[model samples]
Target: MQRRSFASAVSAAAAAPFLMGAAPSGGDTPASAAADKRLKRDMVASLEAELQDRDTARAVAAWIYDIGFDWTPATAPIGAFDFLIAYAFGNRPPANGGDPTKVLAEPGPMNELLADTVAQVRAKRTLPVYAQWEIAHFLTEKYNMSQVIAINPVIAADGTITYLSTDGVAAQIAEKRKSTPGGVGTAGVVGWRDHIKRCVLTTEGRGMKAFAPEGFTMPDTYDPESGQPWTRRRDLYLVHDMNAQWQMKRTELVARMYPNG
Candidate 1:
């Protein structure tokens, strides 16, 4: 959220991101930060407060899907969001105009496009995680520091979806920690953690093509199924193992770290 290239090198000013989460830093690194300790503490506390309200949780869900749902015109949270999710995934032009750039620029036309986008997301994909990543790909780069969300979905073995939030202490450790000397972005956190838990380790290493465009070739064992990128590690985890232990770790970590702090 602080425009620190947590996902991709998404420009903060313009914010055209590839994705919001990291692609596994090849090792287990802590989720520490360089910001003032007091500020981080306050921000975490504020997020906790926000989650207590029903309205806030709804808004957060919409935001997690915003990239595909498109930023503005978030009134129709479910249906509207679903449409944009489709439009974004389709990578098709809006009905208002042939060019998405032009239509997106003008809110009048963009709103119309958004309405249509929601339908597309619904028609094509049932899961909205794809759309969420798309938005994170861009928004996470330049969004204001206060505008961050943790929409990581952890599916339990029993077919339960537990969306991980930034409100958790362990999840916070997955941020772009900068305290380590000579290892600013090299050491990975969230993406890597998901990969380890979700995807089966190959003879080579973590597979991450789904998270990248076709051109950015990774490793040999990184081959993902069609439309299945490493970004969807949560889903992979579900397919491989159906457990909520990871989510439990985050929950426990929160109590230990903020014990009446």
Candidate 2:
């Protein structure tokens, strides 16, 4: 699809209200549930078509909008952080000849990765990139990337970071676009592969012309005993995919149930 048509589709999807029907409740009939399921499926299909469109993927945007992931105090950084680093550095080969598993197993490799990422961002990026949640804060401090704008994360008095919902992040981006002078209305939504479709939907739902290119996949580790890869990351991918489905359905349901609100 052409960029103009894509933008129109996004706007129409964002502005379109839910098909009116009996809302689901505790005493809802099977028919109502079936209707709900069909509605959700149709919405998913529409969003997926946009995501899978080659022209949509190739469409250039003024800003790269990275959706954040979990960042605990103990873990410090998560898979999405690695994705952000890789994107900033243009996914260049690691000094260890592009082996991600080695980068994971080797000591001090992550530090080196950070240093290289910082250098790349500083050299290549002319403007501050927008990243949601605590990843933005962590990237700024650790990579010395003063060029990252963090959106909608709460930092407590004790320094604990509380991240907001994906919808919240999308809404904030929409508001920012409206406020900025001569701001480009399009953005490239970035996140895990399983999560990117939902992110793009939420972004478009907020009236931003957004498309998700191929998302970054986290490297999986092998099982020590079976020598099988993706032992743990398999579960992670499944959980993320399921959660993405639920979140997308819930957003539509909420909008339908509270049409006036």
Per-residue lDDT of model 1, residues 1-261, tens digit only: 543343223222212221222232333243422222333334434644876643333333332332222211101123222111111111223346543323321212222232233233334433222222323333334332122232334556765544333223222322322333433221111122222222211101221111111111112122222122322334553333223334433454467547785
Every model's Cα RMSD, please?
22.0, 16.9
Query: Please, what is the TM-score per model?
Result: 0.17, 0.41
Which residue segments of model 1 deviate by more than 4 Å?
1-236, 239-249, 256-261
> Highest lDDT among the candidates is held by which one?
2
The C-alpha local distance difference test score for the whole of candidate 2 amounts to 0.44
TM-score of 1: 0.17
Task: Provide the lDDT at 229 for model 1.
Answer: 34
Q: Model 2 clash pairs?
A: none
lDDT of 1: 0.28
